[model samples]
Target: MTEAGDDTWLARNRATLARLQFAPQARSVGRVEHVADGIALVSGLPEVRLNELLRFETGQLGFALTLDVEAIGVVLLDQSESICAGARVSGTGEVVRTPVGQGLLGRVVDPLGRPLDRDEALGETVFMPVERAAPAIIERDPVSEPLATGILLIDALFAIGRGQRELIIGDRATGKTSIAVDTIVNQKDSDVICVYVAIGQRATAVQRVIDAVRRHGAPERCVFVVAPAAAPAGLQWIAPFAGMTIAEYFRDQGRHALLVIDDLTRHAATHRELALLTREPPGREAYPGDIFYLHARLLERAAKLSGELGGGSVTALPIAETDAGNLSAYIPTNLISITDGQIVLDAGLFAANQRPAVDVGLSVSRVGGKAQTAALRHASGRLRLDYSQFQELEMFTRFGGITDARISAQIVRGQRIRALIRQARFAPLPESVEVALLGALADGLFDALPPACIATARERLLAGAISGDEAAAVRARLDGIVQDLTREAGHRPSDGASAP
Candidate 1:
C-alpha cells in the first residue's frame, strides 16, 4: 500500500478501536471447541489479544495464551471440570491484574487479587497489571544500603541489599523458606513492605507460613499472594508475577518492598505444564527455552530507582529447589546466573544442627561489604576466612595426626562462632545486637568461653548489654571476658607453634 493509503487505513482503524473501547458491553463471543488440562481452544474469539481475560457462559475466567489461525488457546484460571466443548466464551478485553495499594497490606490474596483473608474485602481497589516492564538501567541506582535480614551469619557475611536479586537455592527441607520467612519477620520495625508469593504449595503449609508471619507481628507490613496446590497451574504460574506487580506499586509510591517467591522450581514446573498444554516446543528437561527470560524479566523488576524518581526499591529473594543438592541442574543454574548471588544451603550442615544451614564457602554476596553496616563490616572482617580455616583444620585433625596448639585454639574459636550463629526461628536479632556480639567476637571476647557454653554466655552477655544499663556489674563482666580473651590469646602454650 502507498504511505498515504496506509496512514488513512491506520487512522480509520484507530477510530474504530477508540469507539470499541468506549462502547458499553462491546464483547466478542466465541465457542469452546475443545477443553483439556485446564486449557480450552475457542474458535470465535477473534478480537481477543494475547494474555487477555475471557468470561465463559458458566462465569469461569481464562486468558488467551495462544491465537492460532482457527482457534485461540485459553488457559483457565479456575476449575475446568464444569467447562466443556461448545460453551460460549466472551472476551473481557482486559488482562489479568491484582489489587495494589496501601489497602493490600496485611491481606492474603490469590493471584487474581481476591481476598482470602476474612478481614479483607479488598478496600480501595487500585489494580495494576500483573506483567510490567522492568525499570530501565538509567532509572536504577547502586544497591549500597543493607536490607538487614537479622540473621547474624547472613548479615555479617552474605549481606543482601535493597533492590538486589538474590537467589536461595538448596535441596528440599534445607531451610530455604526459613531464611526468607526470617527476613520477613525481621522487617517488622522497618518501613519495607513484604510480599510473600506461595506457588504450588499446600493450603496447610501456606497457612502455617501465614501464621508464622502473623506471630512475628509483621502481618501488618506484609502481603500474602498464594496459589495453593488446589489451584490451577495457570494461577500458580501467575502468582509470582502478581506478587511482583504489587511490590512494584509500593516501589513506585516511594516505598521499599521485598518479594519472596517461595520457590521457582515449582513455578517453572507449572509454566512447563502450561507450555506443554499449549503445544510449545519444550527444550532441556521439557521446559521451554524461554524459561530463562521468564525469570530474568521478573528479577529485573528489582531495581534501586534513582533519586530523581522516588528512591524506592523492590528487593527480590527468589528461592529455588535443587534435586539432591544438585545446584548444577538446569533451573538452579539458570537462577544462579540471573541473580546477583545466592545463599547456598547444605543438608549436611542441617544434620549437624546448624539452624540456617548456610554453606559459607558456597554462599556469596556480590554487594558484599557495601550492604553491611560499618560496625558489622568491621566485626566480620576475618570471620568467613577464619571459619573456613577452622573447618579445614578440624577436618584435618580428625585423622589423628599432630595436634598443634594454634590449631586447637582456632578450632575452639570456630566452635564458639558456630554456636554464636545458631539462632531459633522467628528470633531475628537487631543490627545493634548483632554488631555487639560479633564485635565482641572480633575483639577476642568469646574465644575464652567454653565451646558448649558459648550460646548461654552469648545470651547472658547480650542481654546484659541490651537491657541492663551500663551498670558497673555488666561493664566488669564484659571487661573480664575481654581480659580472659587477651589472656587466652597471649598465653605461652607448652610446645606451641605460631598462631593460625
Candidate 2:
C-alpha cells in the first residue's frame, strides 16, 4: 500500500478499534494519535491505560502509558503521517534500550528508559542496542583493579575488582538489596558511575529506591531502571539490559561504571516463562536449558576494555535470590558458574542479628586476593587460618572450663575478626580504614578486648577518629578495657578445672 493509502486505512481502523472493547495481546505496540503537554493517546488501541506499554513508529520512541485510562477516550497524540492509523502494534521491537546522553541521572525509568515519575522529558539521547557483544579478550584488560566497598569483610577479605562478576546469593529478607543500595549510595564522591536495575520490584519499592538515590545527592553519578511486579513479563526480562545500556554509555567515554542487577532471580524467572511460552524445551523445573547462556551473555558484556579501545570498565554485581537459602538450586548454581566469584549471604546469620551478617567461614572469594592490596591478602590469609583452627577446637572444648590457653588466645583473634567486619551500612569504606582493620586483626591488637568491647573498638575505627599512628592510641584504650575485664575474672587460667 502507498504511504497515504496506509494512513487512511489506519485512521478507519482506529475508529473501529475505539468502539470495540477488547484487551490487546499481552505484547503489542501502538502509536500515539495525539500528544499535548506530555500526555498522548495511541491510535487503534483501547484508550492508553495507566500501565500499558506503547511505542512510537517502528521502534524510534517508546514508553509505558502513564495517563488514566478513563481520560483517554478519543483523544490521540501525534497526528504525524507515520502514527496516524493502522500502525503496526506489537511488543517493542528489540529490547527497550536506554537513550544515552546526559541528564538521565536522578530519573526513575522503566525498562524502556521512559520516565516513570513524570518529572521531565528525555531529550536528545545517544542510543545503543541492548544486546551487545562482550569485548574481545585481547581488547580487554585484566581485572587487576580494586573497587573498594569499604566493608572490612569485602575489602580486606573478598575484594571486588573492576570488570569482575560477583554474585550476591541469599534467601529473601537477608538484606541483600540493602547491601547493593548502600554500595551505590556510598559511591557519591568516588567517581564511579552506578546503575541500579530493579527487576520485578513493587512500584512502592521503586519509589523508595529513587528517593534514597536522590537523598545521596549523586543523581548525576547514578541511574535507576525499575521493572515493577505488575509490568508485563517481557518488560521484567529486559530491565537489566536497560540498566546496563545506560552504564555502557558512560564507560565508552572512558569513565568507570558499576552496574548492579539487583535480584536477577526475577529476570531469570521471566526468561523461563517466555521460553516455555515460545515452546522451548524445558530442563530442570521447566526452565529452559539455555538459561545459563542467557545470563552469561548478559554478564559477559561487563569488562575493562584497554585504553586503545575505551580505557573504561563496567563492573557487574548481579544478585540472585535462592529458595530457603539453597545455593544448590538450579538458578543459583548456573549463575555461580558464570560469574568470577560469589558472595553467599547466610539467612541463619542474618536472623541472628548479625548486621551485614555474612558467614565468614562459608563465603569464598576466588578473585578476592587478586583484587586486594598485598598487605590485605597477607593479613586476612593468616586471619582465616587462625579462625578456622580456633572454631574447630572451640566446638570440642565448649563443654568445660579453660581447655587450653592456646585455644583461648585463638578464640580472641577469631572474635576480633568477626567484630571488625560487622557493619550495619553498605557504604564503601575508605582504603585506609580497610588496611587498618586488617593490620590490627593480624597484629593481635584485638587479643585483649572482650567481645562486646571489641565491637565498640571496631565502630570507633570505622568512624575515622583514629587513623595512621592514632589507630595505635585507640588500640591502647582497648587494651585497658581488656585488662580490666580479665582482672575481674582473676586467676581464671590458674584453676583450669574451675567453671568461674
Q: In each prediction, how many residue pairs overlap at the backbone (N, C-alpha, C within less than 3 A)? A: 0, 16
**C-alpha RMSD between model 2 and the true structure:** 11.5
Could you give candidate 1's per-residue lDDT for residues 203-289 as a string of tens digits? 898899999999985898899999998899889988999999999998998889999998799999988998888888999999998
Per-residue alpha-carbon lDDT of model 2 for 315-372, expressed as tens digits? Answer: 8999999888788999999999888888778888798777786656767767778887
Q: TM-score for model 1?
A: 0.89
After TM-score superposition, the amount by which residue 423's alpha carbon in candidate 2 deviates from its true location, in angstroms, is: 1.1
lDDT at residue 54 of model 1 (Cα atoms)? 91
Candidate 2 residue spans exceeding 4 A from truth:
1-96, 398-402, 426-428, 462-500
Model 1 segments beyond 4 Å from truth?
1-27, 462-500
